[model samples]
Target: MKELAGKVKLVIKFFPYRYRDYSRIAAEAAIESWRQGKFAEMHELLIKRSPKLDRDSLISYAKELNLDVEKFTKAIDNQEGAAIIDRDLKLAKELDLYVTPAFYINGIKVLGVRDSDYFKNIIFKELENAKKK
Candidate 1:
């Protein structure tokens, strides 16, 4: 992943649960569109839908951040990046997670994305329980 992408991911980790819905649908839509050669249209939709994410200015911004401009751009343009997104969605689906940002503990569903604290609580409990098995 590009360095900036890693930072963006950490920031995303703090988003309030309610703000993360439809991630799967949106990611799939984006990947599918990009697969169909609608890069410009996809870029427009991203701008219209995610004002904070200014897709149009990403390249310049990445360069400003001192990231590898060519590599970053190439990553986004390839199937790998989108496939990574798709893999995440597929895992979520396999876990029977219908809602965005859902988590599971020992195969038990834990809903919502309230905060890191919520995930920590379930994960810790599950880890303890698993020790007995």
Candidate 2:
């Protein structure tokens, strides 16, 4: 993504699987981190520690990021992230997305895990298409 930093924008939308016991909570933690301007940090940490996304671990990650732990905890407890996540989930459903890590480049939906080269190819193609226009 850094390679296409200036040419493209990345938007992250959360779609926590309802079956995972901690997925929704982790998503809420991410939203709280985003509210504290530490979304990237929290995001990385969550991904790295996905197996341990319990409530305590979530707060620990917030503390590690030096976020306002109390605020984050309160926000998660209050379910502040629910609305935004719900909206994203609704959008995903409307788009017929049933998988994680989906991508849409120029309205071209690409699903499932893809290598960096695959993304680069698509990105370069998009860039070229943009130039032709």
Best by lDDT: 2
lDDT of 2 by residue, 12-128 (tens): 899999999899999999999998999989999999998899999999999999999999999988989999999999999999888998998888889999998998998899999
What clash count does candidate 2 reach?
0
Clashes of each: 0, 0
Report clash pairs, candidate 2: none
lDDT of 1 by residue, 1-133 (tens): 2322322211111112235544333443344444445544654555465534433355454454454557556654453345557566566556666664554455566576677677567666755676798
Score residue 84 of candidate 2 by CA lDDT.
96
Residue 131 in candidate 2 has what lDDT? 97
Candidate 1, residue 75: Cα displacement in angstroms equals: 1.8
